[model samples]
Target chain A: MTQLAADIASTFTAEGAEPFTVDATLEAGDEETLVILGPSGSGKTLLLETVAGFHGHDGTVTVNGTDIADRAPERRDFGFVFQDYALFPHMTVRDNVRYGAQYCENPRDAEGLLAELGVAHLADRTPPTLSGGEKQRVALARALAVRPDVLLLDEPLAALDVPTRQSLRDDLVDVLADVTSIYVTHNRTTARAIADRIIVMAQGQVVQRGTPDAVFERPESPIVANFTGSNVIELASTPAVRSLLDGDTPGRGDAHGNGTAERVAIRPEAVRLDDDNGDLRATVRRVVREDATHRVTLAFDEVTVESFTDSPPEVGTDVVITLPRDRLHPC
Target chain B: MATETGSGLDVKTGRVQTAVLVAGFVGVQLLAFVAAYATGRPTWYAYFMIGSAAVTAYLLDGSSFVVATATLGSVLLIALGLPLFMFVARQTPSLVVEKAADPDVHRVLYLGIYGPLLAAILSLAFGVPLAHLLSEGFSGQPLVESLVDLPLVVPHSVAGILVLFGFGEGGAFPSISVLGSMVGMVLAMAFVAAPYAVNATREAFEAIDHRLEYASRIHGANRWETFRRVTGPLAVRGMITGGVLAWARAVSEFGAVAVVAYSVSFFYPFAGGEVTAQHAPVFVYNTYLQGGLQESGAVAFLLLAVSAMIFLIVRYLTDDNTIGGVP
Candidate 1:
C-alpha cells in the first residue's frame, strides 16, 4: 500500500548563483525505507526539504490519498533530521528529545527513546559536549519522540568518521525496519545498505529507480555507473567488446539514430590479475593498500582500469589480466 | 595541542607581525598626541584620536589581529582615561563626601541614574524588534539599517531639537510637553543611544544558524514559538551587552538632555528649599558656573565613582551563562 506520494517541481535560486530545478515524482510504501541517491548539487536535499514543506514549490503531496500540499511546515507531521544534526546546544539531550511533545498528540517517553537509540547515558549532557556519533543518536531519538509519520533524513551520517558512520548506518538498518522514510545521501553504499527501493538523481531529475541489486548490477547509463563506483572504459579497439557491441553499444553508437552504448562499466573486483591463460596483458601502474586488499591500477595500453587483489605484484611488472565476460555490463 | 620545539612551539602563529604592528600603531598615536599639543587643538585632537583609533582597530584584518588590536587600542583608551583618572585622584575625599551628603546633590544623582535606566529600557523595548526585522532582510534593507543608525550620527543637540519638534506642544502634538520633564530627558537620551542596542542585537541575530529555527518549525513549532524558545536565548548575551552600552551612552549624555531639560523641576515639594534637580552633567556645569571648578570637580568625582561601580557590577552579572548555538 502507498504510504505517501509527492509530485514536486521547484527552482532553487540563490544569490550570485544560477538557478536549478528539482522536479520528481515519488512514492513510498508502508513500512518501507526509500533512499534517494545522488551526487553533490543534484538537489536531493532540496527535494526532501520541499516535500517536508520547508520551501514553497509546485507539487501535490498526499498521505494515504489525502491532499496536504498547502499545509504549513509545522502541520506536516514530518520529522526532519538536518545534516549538521541541528541539536540545541543549550538544552540537555533529554529536553531536546522531549521538546516536540508539547505539539504532538502522542509522544514516546524521551528517556525510553534515548535508551532505545543507545544514548540514555548522555541524557543530561548538552549537544556541544557530545561526540558526533552521540549527537546523531540524540537527533534520531528526538525525531522519533513525536512518532512522526515519515522521517526525512538529510545525510545524517555524512559528518561522522568512518567507524561511527558504519556503526550508525548499521543501527539505522534496524531502526528503520518498520518506519516509512526517505533518506537522501551522496554515498551509494549507505543507499544500498538501507534502501527498499533506490532513486538515482542527476541534475535535479530522477534518472533511474530500482532495488539495490538491480540498480547496482545493471545500471542503464554512464552517469549511474560512474556514480556507483563502476570503472566505465571506452571500447574503441578492445577485441573483448566486439561481440557485446553488436546491438548493445555502451558509447558512441552509429548515427542511424542508434543510442550511444560503446562504453562498458566494469567493476574493479572483476578485473583479475596473474591469470596465466588470460587473453589481455597489462602493466601495473600503482598499488595502494585498502582495508583487506590492494587496489591495483592496471594500464591496458591507453585505458587505465582498477582491480582489487589480495596479493598484488610490484609496480613496473608486466602482468596478465582477464576481463571475465559475465562481469562486463554495457551501461 | 602544541608541542614545544627548541626554537618554537608546534603551533604556527604571527607573533612577530603582531608585535611590529602594535608597536607601529602606538608610535603613530603618540606622534598624533604631540602634534595635537603643538597645534593647540588639544580637545579636538583628543576626540579625533579616540574615534580614529576605534575605527582603525575595527578595520585591522588578517590573522594575529586580536592581540594586535587590543595592544593598539589600549593606547587611546589610556590616553583619554588618564585625565579622568587624575581628575578623580586629585579631588579631596572629605569634600566629595560632604557634597554627597547634600539632599540637592542626592536629587541630581537620582535623576541622572534613573533617566539613563529608563532610556536603556526604552531602547531595548523598541530596538530589539527593529533589529529582528532588519536581520530578516527585505527591499530597502540598507536604508532601514542606516535609519536605525541615524540617532548615532546626528548632533546630540540636533537630536534634541528633532525630538522636541516631533513630540513637543504646537509641533506634532499640542497637548504634549516634552520639555523640562523626566520623560523629556529619557526621550533625549534614547534618541542618541538607540543605535548601539539595534546594531548589537542585529549582529547577534545574524550570527545564529537559521537551521536551528527550521528544525524547530518542522518539529511542530510555529514561527513565534521557535523565535521565543530558540532565537531569544541564543542572542541574549548580545542584547544585554547592547543595553549596557546604551545605558552608558545615555548616562554620559549632556547636550541633548540639557536641551530638553537644563534643570528638571520635581512635581511635589521636597524636604529642602530647592525644588528642582539637574542631571549629573548639567549639575556639574551649573556648579562650575556658580562656584568654579573646585566645587563641581568634587561632585563630578562622586558621580564617576558611583557610575564605575555600577558598570562593573553589571559587567560581572552578564559575564557568564552564555546559551544556544549549533555545535
Candidate 2:
C-alpha cells in the first residue's frame, strides 16, 4: 500500500515582511527524502509548519491526494522535529517518544524503535539530561514512533556540535529509511549529503530545485550558487578542454561557441594538487588548518580556489591544480 | 601581615558596634517590658520604639537581634492579647445549643461562630461612623455635632422647639442619618481600613510570576485550571496575609465609628446592655477618656498587642524565596 504524505504549494510572509512560497510533494511509500535548504528566515519553517497545518496556508495540500488543507495539526498525521529539539523538557525520553503516539494510533513498537535508535538506555532520562546527539536521536525516534505518514525535521543537527552532527546525521539516515521525510536546514553540507531532492529557497520562494548534485552543479541563479557556498569561477575554455566539454558533459555550455564559461563550480575538497601539468595553474596563497586537514588557498589570475589537503604547499609557492573532469560542474 | 592585622582590627570594631547596638535594643525592650508589667498600661508605644530598633537590626541582617526581639514580642502578645480575647469571648455569649433528643447539638456548632459574628457586627456598627469621620471633608460641620443631634432633637421634651429652628424639616441627618445607627458605623470602618487589605493583596499578587501562568497555558491547560493549579497555590500565603491585615484593621477601627453613632453598646444578660462600646477602638478611646489612666492604659495595651500580632503574622506570611527556585 502507498500513501501520499503532503503536497504543499503555499506562500508565507515572515516577520520582516519578506515573503516566500513552497511547492513540494512527498510520497509516503519507498523512502522519499526532500530537504528544504535556505538561509534563516527564508520561510523553510513556515513551509514545514504549513504542511504540518501550523501556518495560515492558502492553496491546496493533499495527503493521499485528498485535500487536508484545513486539518488540525494533531489530525494531520505528520510528526515534526523542531530546531531546538522541542522535545518536552520535562518528559523522560520514553514519554517524549510516546507523545505523538498518544494522539494517533498506539505505536506498539515504540520501545523497539527507541532501542533500535540506541537511545533505549536514555529512555528514563529527561531531554535536558541527554547529550545533543542523544537528544537529536530521541527527537527522531519520537517523530518516527507514531509511524507518521510524513516526517518533518527542522534543523535537527543545528543544535549539535560538528562531530555530534555528523554521527547523528548518519544515524538519522539509517533510521528514516522507507519513510517519507522533509528536512529543513541552512547548512549546505547536511542538505547535500542527505537530500534526495533539494528545494533551495530565498526570501520566500523556491529559487532552485533538483537533485543535490544537479542543483549544486547547475544552480538556476548565481545567488543560489553563492548561498550554497559554490565557488563561482570564470573559466576560459581551451581547445583541448573545449573538445572534452561536449555532448558527453550534461551541463557544459552557455549558448555561444566562444567557449567562455561564465561560472564553474568545483567542490573545495575535490580539487587536488597534481605533479603533472593541469588545466588550472595557481600560486599557493595561504594554508589554514581546519580540524585534522589544512584548507589550502590558491590564486589563479583573478580567482582563488580553496581545497583540503594533508600537506599543503607553502605560501608563495606555485602549484598545478587539477579539477577532476567529472567533478568540474559549469553553472 | 600588616594589612591582615589592619583588616582584623576593622572586623573587631564592626563586631563591637553590632554588640553595642544589640545591648541598646535589649535595654529598651527590657525597660518596656518592666513598664508594661508594672503599670499594666498602654506600654507597647515603648515596644514600638523597641520594634523600630529591631527593624534596623532585621534590615542589617542581624538575625540574633531579630530573634531576640521577636521572642520578646511574641511573649508580650500572648500574655496580653490571649487573655483579652478569652475575656472578650467569655463575656460575649455562649454558642452551645443543647438538644436532649439529638445529644449531638455541639457538633453542629461551627468554629469562631461568635467571635467573627461579633467582630462583623462591631465592624459594621463602628465601621460606618469611622467611614463618616474619615470621609468628612476638611469640613464646615464637625462630625460629633451631627451625631449628637439625635439625642437632643428626637423625643424632645418640647415639640415646640422643632417648630422654631427647622430641625424637623428634611435635615441632612434625617435624609441620610449618620446618627445612632449600625449601618452608619460599618460604612465608616470599612472606608478607613479597606486600603490595608486591598493594598496588601494587590502587592502579593504582583510578586508572583506570570510566566508560570503562560507556561501552563501553552501546555494545553485553560486559564482557570492554570490559575487554580499554579497562581493560586503560589499566592496563597500572600492572600492570607492580606486577609489577616484587613481583618485586624476592621477590628481596630474607631474615629469614624464614633462620629456616626455612639449610642448602642453590645447587650449582655448579666452586664445588661453595656453598649460594648460599639467597636474595639471606640471602647478603648471612651475608656481612656472617662476612666482612671490605668484602665485606659489597659485597653490601649490590648489594642497594641493585637496590632503587633497582626504585623508579625503579615511579615511571616509575606516572606520571599519560600517557594521553589534555584538560588
Candidate 3:
C-alpha cells in the first residue's frame, strides 16, 4: 500500500479562445479510494491524467512522500482504465491482460485476474467482439495485472448499459477494496458507492472535500449541493423555508448577497409529507414514479422542493410538508 | 408541386410526362454523338460525348431529385470509365495474346511494376512515423500536413523537374546520377506517390482512439513500445492500403520517370542486351510515336490487363472487412 499526494495546476488553451486554468490538490491514504466528482469539462480527467504523468503541469505529485511529478508515465507505475475501455482491438482478451504483466517486476497472474473479473470465458475473443461490460472487465484486468502503486479509472463504466453498469460497479467495488485508486465520474451514485473520500470539483477547482456522508448530506457550496443532487432552495422570499432552516448553519451565505443567508439545500428524502400540522404549505406540481419511491415536486410560489414517498399525492393537491430540522443544509 | 388525386387522368398524364422525358434524354445523347462524329474525333470520343449527354440529361431531370442525382452521379462515373473499356474492346484477343508472350513487353511491364513496388515500400517505412506524428498534432502539425499535400497538387511535370534539380547529376548530390538509373526512376515515382501513402496513413492514425495509446503508456510501455504494440498494429490496414494506392500511382507515373530515366539498357553476359527503363506508359507513347497505333495498342492492352489484375489482387488483400479484428 502506498499513499499518493498531488497539487496540480494546468492551463488549457484552445485556438481562438481564452485559456482556462485548473488548480487542485489531492491526498489519499494507503488502500483508500478517492473519488473526484465533477461534470464533463470540469477538469476531473485532466487532473487524473496530469497525476498519471500524461501531461506536464505546475504540480508536485508524490507516492509515499517521494516526488513523482517529473517522472514518465511508465516510471510512475500508475494503471489507467479509460472511459472507452481502450482495449487493443488487434489482441485477444487474454493477450491484452498479459500485455502489462510482461513489463511488471512482480506481475499478477493474468489468467487468475481474468477469472476473478469474470472475463475468463472471453479470453480468446478480441475487443471488437466483446460486449461493453466484457471489454471494461478485460481492461480492468489488464491494468490490475501490472500491480501499480496507484490505479486511475476515468469513468470506467460510463459506456455500458444501465444493468451492466450497475453489476460492474458492484464488481469494481469488490475488486478495488485493497487498491489505492482514484476514480473520476460525474455520476454521484458511482462516487457514493466507491469513494472512501469524495472531492467535489467545479470550474477546475476542488470546491468541497469530505467523507461521502459529509459531502452529500452537508455540501459546503451551492455548486456542490447542485452537483451532488441535493434540492437547493433560495432563502430570499421563502421566510417559511428560512424558518425551517433555523439553527443548522450548514448552508453558507452568497458573497453576492447583502451579507445575509442566501440559499439552503435539503435532500429529497428529508422533505416529508405531513397530514398533521406542518411547518410549510405547498401545492403539488407533479408526481414522478421511480423504482420504489415516488418523487413529488411541490411548489411554494416561485420556489420548488422535491420530496419522495412510497405513495405520491395527486398533482394540483394542496399539501403541507415538513422539512427536517437537522437536515436543512444552507449553501 | 403537383397533387396526386388518384384519378385516371392524373395517372395518364404522369405516364406521358415520363415518356417525353425519356425521349428527350435519348435525343440529347444522339445529337451529342452526331456532333462528336462530325468533328472527326475518335469513336471512343463520340461514345464519351454521348455518355456525358445522357448523364447531364439525368442530372437536369426535375422528377425525384434524389434518384436523378444519384443516377447522374453513377452514370458520370461510367463516362470516365468509357475510355478504358473502349481501349480493351478495340484490341483483338489474338493481338493481346501475342503481346503478352513478347519478352520486351514483359520487361517494360515488370520494370513499371517493380519500381513502384520498391518506392512504395520505402515510402511506408518513412511515412508511417511522419503520418503518426502529424495525426497526433505535434508542434507545427498544420504546417507539416500542408507540406505533405504539395505532391498531390503539383503538376506531374513539375514533380519531375523538382526531382531532377534535387537528385540529378551536378544539381545537389553530383555523385548520385538519377539520370538513366533504377534509383532515379524509383525516386521520381516516390516523389509523386509518397503523399498518398502519408495521407492515408495519417487518416488511419487519426481514426484510432487516443485513449488506446494512453492506456498502453499507463501499462508500463514507453512511447516507442506503445506505438509498436498498439498504434502500429491498429493502423496496419490503412498503411497497407495507402501503400497499394501509392504503388498504383507510381506505376502510372510517366512524366517524372521518363524525365529522370528515359530508357535503361541492361547488358547480360550470356544474352546480348535488354532495355528495361521504358516504363509501360512511356513504352506505349514511344511505340505510338515511332511505329503506329497497331504496335502501341497491343502493348497498351497488355499493360492495362496486367495492371488491372494486380490492382484487383491488392484491393482484395486490403479489404477492410478482412483486415484483422476490426468490427
| Best model per lDDT | 3
Name the weakest run of 10 consecutive residues (lDDT summed) in model 3 chain A: A249-258
**Which digits, one per residue and each the tens of the lDDT, describe model 3 over residues B174-264?**
8887888877888888998999999999899999888888889989899999988988888888899889989999989989888887876
Which has the higher TM-score value, candidate number 2 or candidate number 3?
A: 3
Q: Per-residue lDDT tens digits of candidate 2, residues A1-331?
A: 2355555677754457655666655433447788889999777877777776666566766766788788666566666777776665545788767755544556636688888888789989877678888887887787777777777788899988988999888988876666778889999999988888888887667788889988886675667877777666664534334444555443535566334455567778778898777766689999999989999988877678788899888899899888777776666
**Candidate 1 off by > 4 Å:** A237-240, A243-260, A274-279, A324-327, B1-77, B170-175, B265-276, B321-327
Ranking by lDDT: 3, 1, 2
Ranking by TM-score: 3, 1, 2
Question: What does the lDDT come to for candidate 2?
Answer: 0.61
Q: What is the DockQ of candidate 2?
A: 0.05
DockQ of 1: 0.53
In the range A1-331, model 1's lDDT, one tens digit per residue, is: 4398899999988879999999998888887988999999999999998888888899799988887889988898888888899888779999899989999999899999998888899999999889999999999988888888988899999999999999999999998887889999999989999999999999999988999876786677889988987777777756555544555444433366556656677888888886598757888999999999999998875678899999999998989988776677767
Q: Flag the better candidate by lDDT, 1 or 2.
A: 1
On TM-score, the candidate that comes out on top is 3
Extract clashing residue pairs from model 1.
Answer: A249-A261, A249-A262, A250-A261, A250-A262, A250-A263, A251-A261, A251-A262, A251-A263
- Fraction of the real A/B interface contacts present in each candidate? 0.83, 0.00, 0.87
Q: What are the per-model numbers of colliding residue pairs?
A: 8, 25, 2
> What's the TM-score of each model vs. the native?
0.84, 0.54, 0.87
**Candidate No. with top DockQ:** 3
